[model samples]
Each structure stands twice: as C-alpha cells, then as structure tokens.
Target chain A: MMPGSLRAACVAVLRRDLLLAWRRRGDIALPVLYALIVTTLFPFALGPNDDLLARVAGGVVLVTVLLAMLLAFDALFRPDLEDGSLEQLMLAPQPLALLLGMKILAHWVSTALPLIVIAPILASMLHLPAHANAVLVLALLVATPLLSLLGSVLVALTAGTRRSGMLLALMLLPLCVPVVIFAAGAVSAAQEGLPWIAPIAWLGAALALMLILAPLACAAALRIAIDA
Target chain B: MTAENSPSALLAARDLTFLRQDEPVFGPLDFALRAGEVVLVEGDNGSGKTTLMRVVVGLLHADEGTLYLDGAPLDRDLARGRLLFLAHHLGLKADLSPLENLRIAIGLYGCREAITPQQALHTVGLQGYEHEPVRQLSAGQKKRSALARLLLVPADIWLLDEPFANLDREGIALVNRLIERHVAEGGAAMVTSHGAVTFLHGEPRRLRLSA
Candidate 1:
C-alpha cells in the first residue's frame, strides 16, 4: 500500500504543478490566446454573417478549444519526462494514476479554466443567442475535463517519442469525436429551442467513464514510454 | 542503526533476466543487498548496468525473474516508500529554483526525518544558490541538487546510476561520504560508476555485469 494518504499526495502534486505553471505564465497563456485568436478569426472567415456565425459558433468554439488543448497536451509530460521528474513520480509511494490524474487536473486549471472564463465573450462575439450561452458554458465545463483526461492518455503514450506533436494530434483527434459531437449537439439543441439537457448529460457521463478509465490507462502508457 | 549488521537481505533478485526486442539484454543474474551495506555495480559501457538499476526501480519489467523486498515478492506500492532510485537523469526542472525543486520532491516522497528544503540545499552545498534556477547551475551543482534527495528522503535502498559522473574531486568525495553515512546508518546503496569510488567507511562489495 502507499505510505501516505492518497489525498495528501494528490494535493501536493496538484499544487506543485500549479506553482510551476504559474512561474511560466507565458506558456500557460499560449492556449488561451490561441483559443481567442481562433474564435476571432471565424467572423472574418465566414464574412460576418451573424446568423451563420451563431449557427456555427458552438461547434467552432469547441473545435478551437480542443485544438488549443492539443497544443498544451504535447507539453504536458514533455517537461517532466525531459527533466527526469517523471521518474521520481513513478517512484512515489502513491499510485502513478493518482499522480497523473492530479497533473491532468492542474492542466485543466492552467489551460482550460481560462478558456472557460473567456468563452462567454467569444460566444457573444459570434452572435450566439443568450439562451444558448448557459448551455455553451455548461457543455464546455463538462467536456474540457474529458478532453484533458483523454488527451493525457495520448500524451503519455507519445511521451518519449521525438517530434510527437503531430503524432499526438493524430492519435487524439479520433478519440475526441464523441466529446465534440455531444458538446456541439447540446449547443445546437439549445439554439433550436429544444431540450439540451440530454446531450450535456451524455457529456457528463462520458467524463465520468473517462475519469475511471483514463488515469489508469495513462499510467500504463507512461510506463511504456519511460521503458522505451 | 538498530538493524546494523543484520544478515537479512533488504533487496534480492533471483534469476533476473531482461530482454530487449525479443533478445536477452542481461540475464539470469542473482544478487542480494542487505541493510548497512553498499554494492558497487561494476560493468563496462553498455553492459546493462543502467538497465539493471532501472529494472530494480520498476521503470522496466524483468522478462524472466523474481525480485524480493524484505523476503517477499516486490510490490511497487510497498517498495516505493522503502526504495529511492536516482537514474542517470538528474530529474531537476530547469525553470524551478533548487529550493522549489526540493520542496516538491520532499512533498511527493517524504523523508523520515523532516527537514526543510533550505536545509537540504545547504546539505548539498547549495546554500547561496537556493533561489537560482537549476538551468543556471553547473553540471556538478545540478547533480548535487539531485543528490540532495538522498539526504532528504527516507528510504532503505538507493539505486544510483553514475552518481560520480560530472563531479569534481570534492564532489566525488562528497558522494562517497554520503554513501558511507547512509550505509553506516542501516541503509543499503547500489551504485554504478565508470570511475573507482574510494569509500570512506570501508570497501563496497562488487557486482559485475558482463555484456
């Protein structure tokens, strides 16, 4: 059994990662800035048709946030792997999955939390209706953690490989389809004045399932990467 | 030191064999480490010395063998708290100061005797440079920073890979002194080094792996 309390270990890992991310504020801002820029470009690309922008805004924002998350995912384990901190983590008395889960939580806080905070502004800029705004935020709230969890598995799998960014994207995109579909479906339902709760619930369910399975899978993949 | 001179083996490997890509890398090796002892793994370049340490640390799985900790089959959860492995990589983040790094390290795998990060840095001769980013430190300093974990963390077994590399004469002597103190205090250390290490306490037992 692990020596210390699991809660304490998880908290320590989470706090340490957050502090490290705080020190490198510029790196934390990259994904949020990327999301903002990507959201802003949609209006120009589709010629400022408010209806068109609103119609696509839900899907567009989810896609851009995912893309931004992808940018952050590639570096999730890279720094730890390069600097040998990952090996120490493996040696921790706590379970590797627990530690990895904490890292994923910190990633969401640093990368996705800001995006969630700014998402309403992006929604308004896209002419998304006020009714759908709450649904949009809710969908993203459930979906981003799922994305971080799933993305962590992929990142762990590709942790030690050279030039893994493109490889990570390829491995992650197909797995992310369900999140995108469910998240966008919820917003689309809200846009059409239909009940949006079902899709959001589905997103939550997927997040729950991933919460159980992803950390263990990511830990196994991390072992493989380190051994390789 | 209550367990000093105890014959009971703290760590043991039986017929331990590891393979890479369907071929045996190192094979069917047997060794035992007891409390209050130091074992130097003597091997030439690419003789799987590092791999052996990695296997012991659970970073790599053994293809054909059993490892025992305290006479039972090794379980990672139990082994982790009792074992500390310092691999070839120093494991220090370049962006973080030595103090920050030590705090995280101690928080994750706690020490038996609680000592602050500052004290650990001072123990490693990094007193004045506690707040400087590790990237700014020389190779020897970085290695010393990593070595501080041995002092700060509480573990019975130490698997050190090239602990003497990149150290000045004084730094090498420092490592020797630390290992001597650790072994004398009922801890066992297994170290792999290209250069000969002159132990301050006594000569370390040898385990040679041939490629």
Candidate 2:
C-alpha cells in the first residue's frame, strides 16, 4: 500500500471527475446544444440582417456562453453533496481548497471548454467579424473560467437545499454582470477596431484572484452546509 | 501515526454534547478508547447514536465540550487522515465502480501498509464485482464496497455509525471479522448498533447513550 500524496490525490480527483464526465457524455453535450440553439435563434428573432447580427454577435456569444454555463451549474457540486462524496472529500487529509480547485478545473474543462470550442462557430453564425474571432475566443478563454470559479462558491452555498436551481440562477446572474461586461467589452472593442487588451487583462486579473479565493470560500461554505 | 509517540488514549471525550436549534441532541458524555479497543455505542432510536458518531468524527461540532485525540485537542487538521467515518451514506459514487471508489479513497487517505484496492475489495466479499458500477449493486453489496474502504485507508480511528445495517448474516460475520482483525492490529474503533452484534473475541466495551 503506497501512501497517497497531495499530488496523487489531486490527480485522482481530476481523473475521477473527468472520467465521470466522459461516461455521462450526454450531459456534457446539453450545454453545447443549448448554446447552439440559443445562437441559432438570434438571426430568426430579429431578421437575418448582417449588420444587426454582427453588432450583437460579440454580446450574443458572451451571454449565450454564460447562460449555457449556467445550465450546467447544477452539476458542479450538487451531485457530490447529495451522494456524500463531498463529505468524503472534506474529510481527506489534503487541503479542501486544493481538491475543490481540481473539481472546478474539471468543471471548466467538461462544461465550458466544449462551449468555448464552439464559440467562434456560434459567433460566426451570428455574422461576427472574421478578424474579431480570435479576440472573442481569447475573451471566452479567460471569462468562462472566471464565471465557473465564481459560480462554484454560489453553488456551494446553495447545496443541500431543495429548489436550488432557480436560486443559483438568481444569485449567480447578478454576480455574472461584471464578468459579462469585461468579456463582452473586450469582444466589442475588438470588433470596433479598438485595443481590446485592457478588458481581457481585467478578466485575467479577476480570474487569477478567484482561482485562489473561490475554492477557499467553497471549502468553508461546504463545511457549513454539511454541518447543518 | 508517527513512531516514537508515547502510549495514550487514542480518543477521549469530556462533557461532549451536541445541540440542534438549542435543544440537546446528545450528552454531556464522557468516554475514552485506547488502542486495540472497540467501543460499542448502544442507543435506542433518536437517542443520539448517530449524532455521537458525527461529533466523534468532527463532522458536527459539539455544542459544548471538547474531544481529544492521542491526548491532544481534536481539530479539523489533526483529525483528518487520522479518523475514518462510515455512516448511513457509504460515500461511494454511484457512477463509478467499487474499485474506482476504493482508489479515490486511497488517493485521499493513502493506503494501509500492505493492502491494494483489489485486495481490499476481495476481503470485503466484492471479488467478482470489481468493475461494476456501484449503482447496479444491491444495498448490501454497496455496504460491502464501503467496507472495502475501511480495509484500504490508513486512518487509526474508525467511527462506524451502523456497520450491521442492510447486511446478511454472512455480511455481519464478515464485519465482525474485519473489526477483530483491525483491533488486533492495535487500531481503535467506535461502532454503533441496535445490540444485535456478538463479537468473536469474547466481549467488547459498551458505551451506552441515554436520551
């Protein structure tokens, strides 16, 4: 019996979550499908005007991705909390924050990565500029993770409570305002032929901060959830 | 457990009581468990048996009183990797197989000196269902899968809320055998049940909780 190290624990948890996500491959597709349907409707709703679609394309993709991410938020920690796996995770010897960080990483990879991969396609479908496509993807690359990290803390707080799906949306959407602003700001700036680096840099700074703090908040919130 | 440590009580409780909504759930209780000892916690329904077990494992903080491990105050940091808890929830992932579940536990708590996940599953009577998803297993088999975790983890203290629940006669005997082997190896355990267990090693100490 080899003693498990902190690194081993992290790897094990990451692999476990990824494997579970892979097994439930259909669940991973729901958000992508949701994003696909939502992006497809923008043209039909407001007429197929290229200017209108192009103007709204950056904002549309950002909000669509954010909302798509929200669709999968319930899967973040609720299942683990209900099945007692979260309790086991808390009881592990390693720092709870580190383990949760791993979980958050897996969540971003499975849920948001797919949406990001399809983002340019989704944006281009709305007539978003070809030159602005890189900026859109780059902004999403930073913004999606920030949303995931922030959403994890809210998910942790609402765990173990019934009817949390709506509550999660109500609470998370307000907090998502800033993330959406910076991300959409970057994309729009790029489309308007302006320097878009500042907003993306802001998103990066916030991501760095949340990447450190959100997991610690999740650890504390979940301990309280389990305690109660 | 580190070497060169002095012999002392593995676990001790002093006026340890838990309250819910300002109502007393359990004691103001006192107890101590030494190495190689098993304390049988006997209580009636809603008599704080599970509550006591949760407090012992630090899942729920005591409303009033202190708990000590190896003669030092029990805190979250110290209690982790040292205490193993198996309550009503087996804590296994339904989507993963028993083997994968055991591997996750091992990854968290580290393995015991000489046991592998496969060996632990075999010890717990889950030899043939190593890769079967835990959701497909029956209630007793799920419990057995959790029991495999007890074999693989290296924690020194075991707090089993109800080891006999949802088990057949052979499963009960299997649990007793595991406890006996665990105790003989100088590990301490506190088990709660409805007084149906008959130990093979003569008799164990009983800690009764009164409502």
Candidate 3:
C-alpha cells in the first residue's frame, strides 16, 4: 500500500471542509448575523446614551462575540460525526490530531473569522472609542481562535450526547472564563489608557498552548466519544 | 468457525472480545483474513458485525485479545492505508459532487497508480452523475459513489459492512465484481450481510456471529 502524504491529506481535509462550508454558506452567515443583531440590540436596550454605550461597548462586544461563537461551535464536529466523514478522517493514514487541527482551523475561518471581520463595525456601533476599538479587534484576533480551540475539545467531548448544545455551553463556561477575562481586560485597559499588551499576551500564550494541545485533546475525546 | 491462523495472512485476530457496558458483544472470536481472499461476516441485525468491523478499524477497542497485521501485533499506525472500511454511512459529503468526494478520498487515502478520480467514477457507473451532488443521488447511487473508493485507493484489506443494504440487483453485482477484482489483484475483503442474496461465486469464506 502506498503511504498517504501528510501534505495531501491536510489539503484534502481543509478543502473538503471549506467547500462544505461554501456549499452551505447560510451557516457561515448565521453567526455573523447573530453577532450583528446582538450588537445592534445593545444600544436600544441600554438607552441611547453615548457615554453609557462607550463604557459598556467593549465588554458587550466581547461577550456578544463569545456567545456568537458558542452558537456556531456545536457544528464543529457534529455533521462530520453524523455522516461518518470523521470516521474516515480517523482511519486515514495521517495523524487524527493534525486532521482535526485543520478542521478547527476551517471552523474558525467559517465561523469566527466573519465575526472578527465585522468587529470594528460592531464596536463602532456601540460608540467604542477608536483606540479601544483597535484593541478590541486585536483582542478578538488572538481570542477567537483561542475560543475555537477550547470549544472544539468540548464539542468533541459532547459529540455523542443527544442535544449537546446546552451541555456544550455549560461545560465551556469555566474554560471560556479565562479567555473572556483576558480579552475583555485588554479592551478595557486600552479604554482606560493603561497598557493592554499584558492581557493580549496572556490570551496569545493560551492560544499558542491550545494551538498545539486542543486538536490532540479533541482527537482523543472524539475517539472516546465514538467508542460506543 | 475456523481459525486458520495462516502465518502469511495479511490480517488475523485471536480471542477478540468486545464488551458493551462490560457485557460481551462478541467473545473470544477468532479469524484470519489472508490476502487474495474474501470473508463474509454473516450475522443477524445486532449480531455485532458492525461493531466487529469498527473494532478492527480501530474505532472501537476490544476488551480482550489481540489483532495481528502481517503476523505482527496490529499497530494502528502501520495498519492505516492498508485497510479500507465502507460502512452503512457512505461517508460521501451530501453537498459535494461525487467527483469532488472521490478526489477528497483519493487525496486522503492516496491514489492507486494510473486511476484518476474521473475514471474511477465512470467505472462505478456514475459517469453522468459525476458532477451531481451526492445528496440528490438515490441511496443506491450514493453507495456506488462510495464503492468507487475501492478502485481509487490502494488498501490491501477492505472491510465493507452491509455493502448490499442500499443496492439494487445490479449494484449488488457491481459490488461482487469489485470484490472479485480486488481479490484477484491480491487484495482481501471482509463483507457483512444478513440478507439471503447470492454472494460472489467460488464459495467465499463465511464468518458467522450468532446474536
């Protein structure tokens, strides 16, 4: 038997996922729309005061993006799990962790990247100061992938469970706390004119750590989840 | 049941037992699948055939006993790319065209020499439907799209669970032809079916599991 090429397998996994996301482009739009709607609702509910909106804008956008990502995260592995594509991926000659990492990368691209692309607009909508808005974007840039990496493991762990959406959120809350803290801390520090690089650095460190570990964890979790 | 334990068998298992919640799904089972052979895992619904396939594919671990690949302890790393498994779930992305799906399979499994994805699709009787999304194809057509992988990927062992489930008479014949060609080319296949349809000629080996 010819040994499968890791490069070819990685490209295949990435292309398959991206193509699937394109075919059902509505799904990619869902989280973006959700983020938009949630960001739009804040000023209305919190009253039209610029000071109030600016003060709360960074935190609100961070939480909204977090919740929006959570909304889209359940799908990271569910479709593949149901369709047995994931099984094929597992049996492929390449390391399952590497394939899963590609999947997480694709998921981040389809779901979180869109949200991040619109973050500046979202932040501006809530009257976030321009400097703090840049920090918010920077924070999300490092943070969303961190959330995606963390969320993927939880999603894989709950994969075999029925209606795992709520269970996913509950299980992820504790893990997401640190991510949220660091991200929001960065934005708020920028707002207060304090150096925000420390919190951004923390999130980057965590993202770098999860960048190596989450896929490995997710692969093991999926293997265990599908054991029945 | 017979356990030939051929020294040159490409794949063999000894006393393989799997437990579901600590209750044995199959116990102390033994079999050897040599190259250029076809083994039919015949059993009723819930007879652990699919579970056995999944176990051999390394998705599920056996509670007890060992699996050997080429007379050595089955190392999953080494066994991959050598075993091809086609389960009830065809694994074709419903949204992708069959050609694209086949390309992904070839990309992951590595292509058999000289066989293009288009040629494989045409060989599987999916020529005109090559660009049709798998979701729109009939159930039988979806199965054929998956069967095309057998032609495009270079796996020495094929584990096909319920290969006949969604096929018409012609599709069944196509499967037999594929298996015969695979075995003729020195590859082996283990097919599981519970129905009473006629199988490949030459009295292929049967491994039965009682529910």
Candidate 4:
C-alpha cells in the first residue's frame, strides 16, 4: 500500500476514468451490449436444443466476455499517452505502478463490473444450467479484471504504433487463452456435474498473478509508447 | 536522501544521448540546473526538444550517459517525484470538466497539500469555467486548464516543452507570471520555446539542437 497521498491520487484517477466512461456511455455500454448480442446469437446460429445449449453456454459467455473486454481495451491509455496526459502522469510523484493500477481499477469497474452483473442474464438466454450459470458469473467476477489488467499492458505496448488495435489483439489474444480456458472450464465442469473448484482456483491464482505483474508491465510499456 | 543543505546541482546530466527510430535525437551532452535557475533548450520541430526533456525528466532513459537529481542518481520513480513535465500536447481529458481534470491530476501525482480546485482554477485564469468540460474550452483556455496542475502540486524542477506555443497575449503573460512565481519559490525550470519570452525574470541560457 502507498501513502495516503498517492492512494488518493490513484483514487482520483479511478474516479475520473469512471466518470469519463459514464459521460461517453457508449464506450463501455457497447461492449456489454456486444457480449449480450453475441451470447444471444449462439442459439440462433446453432439450434434451439436446450441440452446442446447447456453444454455450449459456458464457452459462449466466456468467449463473448473476453471479446468484450478486448473491445474496451483501446480506451485504457492510448488517448492519454498520445494527448500528453501520460506525460503528466509520469511526471507525478506517485509510483507509476500505483497510477497504472488506478486506470486498471477504473477499467474493471466500467467494463468488467457490468459484464459480471449481466452474465447471469446472458447465461439464461443461452439456456445455461442454473448451477453452471452461477459458476460462469462467479468465474467472470474473478477473471475479467485479469483480462483487463493484462490487456492494458498490451494496449500500452502498442500505444503509438500505426496498427495498434490489431497489434494489441495479436499480442493479447494469446495471453488470454489461460483465462478463457480456466473460466469457461469451470462453468463447463459445473454443467457436467463435476467439481469446478480446480479451474476456479486456477482462475483466482491467475487473477492474483496478473494483479501483481500487470501494473509494472503497463508502466514500462507506457514509457516506451511515450518515447516512440 | 540527499540533504538540501549540501551544495549540489539539483539536476545534472552527463553525455546524455537519445535515439529515436534509429536516428540520433540529441546529446552526448552535459548540463546542470541548480535551484532557482532557468535553462532554455532551443530547437526546431523534430530536433528532439521534447525528447531531451523526456530523458531529463526520466520518462525516457538516455541511450548513453547518466542523469542525477538532487545529488543522487536518477531513477524513473525518484525523478518523477522531483520533476514536472509539460509537453506540447495539452493532455486535457476533453470529456472531463476542468475541475475534474485538475483534481484527478493532483490525485494521480499524489500531491499532499494540493490546492483547492478554486485556487488552481483562479491561478490559471479559469475561475468561472471550472465546471465546463475541457473540450468546450478554446485552445488557449484548454492550455490554461492543462497548466492549472502546476499550481496544485509542488515540484522542484519544471520541464516545459513549448509552454507558450498556442497562447494568446494574455495567456502568454500568465505563463510568464507562473514561471516567475515558480522561480521565486526556489524552484528551477528547463524549457523549449519558439521565440524570446521577455517576461522571464532571468535570462535563461540557450542550447540549440540541429537536425
């Protein structure tokens, strides 16, 4: 934990980030909508069989949430880095790790929080088994922040590049595989009436690992982005 | 911690070199800035005026050489605490109100004894416009809003790249006063600008870079 002053600064950044997401509603809302629409389309694209839907629902919700997280990743720091807010942020006395954490925190609140709240509803639309749906939302609540935190680093890495969004997806999609596998696996295991604890524990561990390392990576990448 | 009472250069750089996109930007250079002194970095576009400041401020490390702040070797985090950088881009969050921006900035910097929003706004000549989103402000007004952070935080060194490029006469005057006030408070500043600013209390030594 940082001193109160630095913590306050991080909180300030988090607040501003959340407020901006509120003001632009569409930036964050669109991704949640994308997740919902994509999840809903699975039944139509495949078939109306409840048994098939139950088996596929976990993967559908997990994949859609992953895509939704990526969609909003661009908003993390590129604008601030390009427009000079990054320089101000770098110049501030607060540690870059803490400052980056604040942005990641903000991103989770706006993007992941909504996804968690809405995952249950989307799961029902997919005809997911009730037990599996609970596991799906729970896994997401634990896993989505990991995606945002790690994805933010990749976003920072490609910050000033010509094809940043494409580059970010290329770099990040691979790293996100574990999260997808573990989170979706948890729900799938629940659907099969197997204990889902192993995958859930893995997801929790991955989230903790990401929480520790992602801020440092994002801060270093931000320095590169600004220099470039 | 390096004691302030010791006779030392607040900022010192030796043979600093920076490379951008495989092209040498500036340096293999040396310089020092002491308390209350001002240093002027002069160069045309793409000549690395911004790059040099970035390196000095420890946002970008030099390809060669070493930097020192307050008699200690400069690290990114330590240097960040000692220096303030204002870049050519205004860095304003267009969607955020001016007060929101300043308060957020102060928060991000972890400035204790940070000024109230009213004081920061008044200092930047933005008194009545605190609640308006920065995007709604004019170019000069936006710049002022960006600069409002200076009043909210206490920094030992100021690195400004083109502090007056897009300002009106009044804005320029305001910038001058701000710089003068910063110096009066025993702080040092390094800046790059297009032309002479007559209002700086002391003549800053000029260093020019050629592409």
Candidate 5:
C-alpha cells in the first residue's frame, strides 16, 4: 500500500538524495568546480576590459550556468539508476511523482541552489553592473531550479542511453532555451534600466510548469529507463 | 486499496506478454500467488526469468495483459508495500554501511513492524559488521545483507530473481531456511532460478519461461 501520508514519503526521498550527495561529495564537487572554471573563462577569452565583459556577461553567465547544471544532471539519477536504487524508489508505495519531486528538490538544493549562492562572486568577476548583479543572481535563483527540474526529466527519460550525458544535453538544451533567454533577458533589461517584469514572469511561469509536469515525466521515463 | 474482505489472489498475471527490442521475451504468460503457496519459476539462460519477475513486480509493464493484487489492479502504490522483490542486482548501496542500507530499505518499504536496526543486523549474520561499508563486504556477505531484509519485514508476496546467484553453501542454506520460515508462516513467494531448489517442503507450482 502506498503510504497514507504522502508527505512522509516525500521527506524520505528528499533525505535519501541529500545523503547521496553528502556521501559522494567528491563527485558532486567536480561538477561544481567545472562550472566555476567554465564560467571563469569568459573574461579571459574576451579580454579584461570591464565594460566589454559586462556588455555580454549576463547571457554568458546564464548560459554557462545552465550548461554547468546540465553537465551535473546526468549524475543526478545515473548512479542510483545504475546501482538499482531507482527500482526500489519506483516500487516504493509512495507516488513515483512525489518521490521524483523530492529528488528534484534535493537536486535543486545541491546543484542549482548552490549555483545561485555562488553567482554573486562569479558576477563580480564578470564585472556585472551593481543593479544587474542583483538581478542576475535573483534571476538565476529563480531560473536554475527550473533548469534542474527540466534536466531531471530528461535525465530520467534518457536514463540509460549510451553516452547519456551527450544525449541529455542534446535533449535538454533545446528545452532550456526559453529559461536561458528569459533569465539572461531579465538581467539584460535591468542593465538597460527597462522594466524586466515580462521576462521574470515568463521565467516564473516556466518554473511553475516544470514543477508540475517534470516529475510525472520523470516517473514515466523511469519505467522505460529501468527496462533499458 | 481493495477491500480486505474479498478473497482475492495475493498476486495474479493474466495473459501477460513482454518483448525486448522486438524479441519476444515472454508471451501469453499467466501466474498467480495465493496465501500459503509458493510458486517456483524455473527457466534456462535468456529465457525471460528475470524479465517475468520484473513484469510481475510492475517494474516492467507487460506488453499485453492485466495484473491484480488482492483483487485490485496492480496499482503501483498498492504493489509497493505488497511486493517484496529481490532482483539479480542486489540493490545494496556500495558506499553505505549495511545498517544504513537496511534503514533506507525499511524506510522505503514503510514497514510498520520493521525490526530494530540491531535485530536486522543479527538476522543477516552481520551483528558486528553492520557498520562496515558494503564495498568492503564479500559478495556472499552482501547477498546475506539483502536476504536479511526479508526477515526484518513482512509483505503480501515475495518475488526473488536469482536469489541464490553468488551465495556460498552456508549462505544458500540460510536463504533456504528463510524461505522455509516465510512459507511456514503462510506468506506467498515466487522465485526464479536456473537450478532446482531441493529444500522446499512441498512441490511448489512451477512455471517455465523460454526466450
């Protein structure tokens, strides 16, 4: 029987994911550092002129951060899936959607949430304007979780595909385009002192939609993935 | 959930069919488990034994057929608690200690009468080694840790796929004892294996799967 208490199952899955991240701290850190390094290359490649870097920094940071999240995403369910913990999760009486939601939330905490927290320091390195800096981080705080949620669905969908990392990026980058555009556009509008409410609202809408549907997709994908 | 008042089969599969990449795995398959009965599923290599087990557990939906648990359609939620399945892959976390692994397993199964962590350790024959990481354990020891899961909790039906895969003689004896105890208690089980199981008390109903 599925647990009478859905909330308890959700909490349980969330705790399990967090524990996984904690135990495999090295694997988790490598991706985070990879993101940091990839983001750091922007100024060096474009020359150190602060104004020139600032002009394109918003898009660069958002795209790079989104890429970083995608890079780490294949790791999200792959290890568990390979090791068969995924089957246990699937067979748990709790709704797979709810359990997947807990996992996505944990992914956000460990991946996107940390990215948002670290955005400020990276933003400074990119010479983002003061107002745009806050906007960039705020937009990322809102946006990256959406990326994580969507990435999770694709990761689950393509769970055991050969070269799944590449496939995941192929499948998710297109889906993530809107999030990348709206997030970077929000910062861009703020940089020009224009009302960026439309893009922010769009980003929020994307997040809300993904929050609702991604887990279900992930559950269905898990069924197929497990077979593979 | 289905009404407990109904005298429904604990597990049933009707006309189940499954294919992998266009190759027929199992077709027109039918099986059931009643209270106090054990079903021994036997087959040769590549004969869909594991696939049949997966389909029964709802891990893989049959390409064509219906399944029911306790008179209810094998709803994923209901099956979760009603079925205790051990796949070919032991599913033990390599990094976690055995005790930690058992705790996660208990939590996932949501067993109301779950044994204490210590009892689980003792039942698995790992009383002093519960704290040792799974990566350090021998294959048979890890298999024992998984079998211990059966002792710590109860389920409506048990599905074991190659449960004796890597066990030593003693480990095999212990597993047979566990199965005997479970059957003696009136629980149902469906196990698949390539070799004959000699210790079963009664002639278990047999189902053969072929590629």
Candidate 6:
C-alpha cells in the first residue's frame, strides 16, 4: 500500500470512532457525570470543613478522574471485538500500532476530554483552592491521555473474554499509580504555592514514554486476544 | 484471467498447522490457490474450517507452517491490501448506519479508486436502507452491508467463512454473483460452507478437513 493510503487509513479509523462516539453521546456523558457526583459527595461524606476538603482535594480529583476513566476503558475495544471490526483492523495494511494509536486518541477525545474540561468544577466543588485549578486541569490534560493510553493495552488484552470489566481494572490500576501520584502531587504543590511544573513535567515525560510504547503493546495484546 | 492457467499460486500454504490448547486443529496440510479460482473448504463442526480462514487472514498465526502470497513469503502488512476476509460476525458496527459502516470499511482497507459508499451500498441491495443502523437491519441485509466491502475495496484474495449463512435465496445468489465476477476479473477466493453450491462461473476446487 502507498504511504499516503496508510495515513488515510489511520485518519479513517479515527474519524469512524469519533463519529460513533458522537452518535452515542449519552454513553460519553456517563464518566463525566460520575466524576461530578463522586467529587460532590466528598465534602458531604467528610463534613463541611473547608480546610479538610481543600487539603485532600487534589488527591480526590485525581482518584475520581482515574476511576471515571476506567469506566470508559471497558468499552474501548469491546464493541469492535464483538462485531469483528478488530479482526479487520488486524488485517489492515497499516501497521497495527499506528492504527491502535488513532483508536487511543479517539478514546481520549470521546471519554477523557470532557473529564479534563469539567475537572476544575469538580475540584472547586470539593473546596480545592482556586489557584490550583489551572495546574489541576493541566495535570489532568497530561495524565488522562496517559490513563487512556495505558488502559487500552489492558482492555485489548481482555477484549475476548466475557465479563472483562473487573479483569481490565485489575490489570490497569497498578499501572496507573505513578500517573496519579505525579498528577496529584503537582496539584498539591500548586496548592501550597510551590513550583509545581517539575512533577507536571515528569508526568509529561511519562506520557511521552507511554506515547511511544502503549500503542505497540496494545496492538500485540489485541492479536493475542483475537488468536485466543 | 490468463493467470488462472499460469501455474503460479496466488496464495500457497506449506505444512500449515494450528493448535488450540496444545491439540492440533488442522495441520500438515498443503494447498495453493491460483488467480481466477475458488477453493471451497468443507468440514464438520469443530473441524477447523473457521480456524483455517483465520490463519489465512493472519488473524491467527500457524504453529508450524509457511505461507506465501504471489510467490513471495507472506508478510501480512505487505499482503493485506491484496486480501479481504469476511467472517461469520460480519464486522458491522450495529450503531452505525450502513453507509457509515461501508465508508469506514472501505477507508480502512484503502480503496483502489474513488468509489462512493452510496454506490457500494446500492450494489449490495441496501440502497433504500442506507441510513438505517445495522442493528435495525434484517440479518440478510446486515450481511449484504458487509458484502459491500467486496465491491468497494480493491483486494485480489477473498476469504469467506459461511458466506451463505443467514441469507435468503436472493441474498445467496448475490454472494455467488459477487464471487463469479471477482474470479472472472482474476481475483481469487476461498469459501467455507457445509455443502456445495453451484458456481455461476469457474470450476471451484474443494478441500475437506478431517477432525
């Protein structure tokens, strides 16, 4: 196949996924709603102490977003696997890793983009300091794609199994630890008026590394799942 | 069409074997498919007909075998643009309309020339139902929607598993016509069915698998 055609294939997969997500916009809203509800419940469960809520707000938002993102992960490859589009993907002339990268990008656009946009509302709802909001969103911007990218590999591994939600979470949660730590740590530092760019930069670095490796791993895992 | 008599294989398998749970599914089998020819694979349940197609499409790796495409060792990425595999699942996204599904399928496989999704849908007898979501289509229509890929995409080899399964008489005839035109144009196909159906064109070779 021509190089131009390969690039066209990637764009086609990306557009197709985005169009599908747009058609099912209700499903896309669930994760954002979950983030909002969970973030709102924090202050109620811990009493109305602003200091206490604000102190833990960074960690709370990170954990909530992570959990919300996990909800979408179960769906990343399930629809394709069930309908056999995954088999077509494997057989495409384009490199599987390149094709999977487009899919991960689409997943982030559909699921994680909304969470990042609304995260500050949730953060402020939890009484998180106003100054830390930008850093929180920035951290989320970097970390959420990391979550989608890393989570996709696990999702691909479990795509063929029935009831793979719990298995996907089990496989993915451990891998998300560093991203959560760095993102939450950045927000907490910003809350304390410290220079927070270092941790956020570290998160970016990790994301860059994941960008290079996650798609390849996910593609390999998809092949295994299909062959099983 | 002259390549049909050229004595060269378009697709060839040497000592192909696949195992599930360490037991052989089908193995040590050798076959060659030439241009403008059809090979019908027959087998009983669990006899590995589907597995063989899966292996041929590179969805599953043969445990021990060599596969060649057009006289060269098979490199899936290089050979992919030349092949299309239609399995039992149909590969349609239920939420998407037939037009959208065909567009995506054609785009992914990289069409040889500009062919509108509408034209492909029309050819597949889905003209009136182009915008209906696949879930709303009857089983035969869904299969036809998937079959639109054969008309829209440029591929020389087609691997179909139970292509006649869910189709009514007319739908079955549609598949046979597609196969006939494809082989007549020098494309090759391998189809698996429980029993044989009359081909409208070239003589179809048969390969039977034993459990």
Best by TM-score: 3
TM-score of 3: 0.98
lDDT of 4 at B161: 78
Off by over 4 Å in 6: A1-4, B1-7, B196-202
Model 3 stretches with alpha carbons more than 4 Å out? A1-3, B1-4
- What TM-score would every model get versus the actual structure? 0.94, 0.96, 0.98, 0.92, 0.92, 0.95
Deviation (Å) of B62 in candidate 3: 0.5
Residues A171-195, candidate 4, lDDT per residue (tens digit)? 9878988888888888888988999
Residue pairs clashing, model 6: none
lDDT of 1 by residue, B120-209 (tens): 778878989999999999999999999998888888899989888888888888898889889889899998865345333467778888
Q: Each candidate's DockQ score against the native complex?
A: 0.53, 0.68, 0.68, 0.56, 0.49, 0.61
Tens-digit lDDT string for candidate 6 (A1-228): 342277778878998999999999999999999999898888889999989999998899889989998888887888888788888888887888999999999999999999988988888887888889989999999999888889988888888789777777788778988888899899999999999999999989989999989999999888888785
Local error of candidate 1 at residue A52 (angstroms): 1.4
In angstroms, give how far residue B98 of model 1 lies from its true place.
1.4
Cα deviation of A40 in candidate 6 (Å)?
Answer: 2.2
Give per-residue CA lDDT, model 5, range A17-96, as digits (tens).
Answer: 78878888776676568768987888778888889888888887787778778878877787777777888778877778
lDDT of 2 by residue, B6-35 (tens): 346788888888998998988888888889
Clashing pairs in 3: none
Question: Which scores better on DockQ, 4 or 5?
Answer: 4
- lDDT of residue A227 for candidate 3: 86
- Model with the higher TM-score, candidate 2 or 3: 3
| Rank order (by lDDT, best first) | 3, 2, 6, 1, 4, 5
What's the CA error at residue A86 for candidate 4, in Å? 1.8
Clashes of 4: 1
- Clash number by candidate, in order: 0, 0, 0, 1, 0, 0
Kindly give the stretch of ten consecutive residues in candidate 6 chain A with the minimal lDDT sum: A1-10
**Candidate 2, pairs of clashing residues:** none
Q: List the residue pairs that clash in candidate 5.
A: none
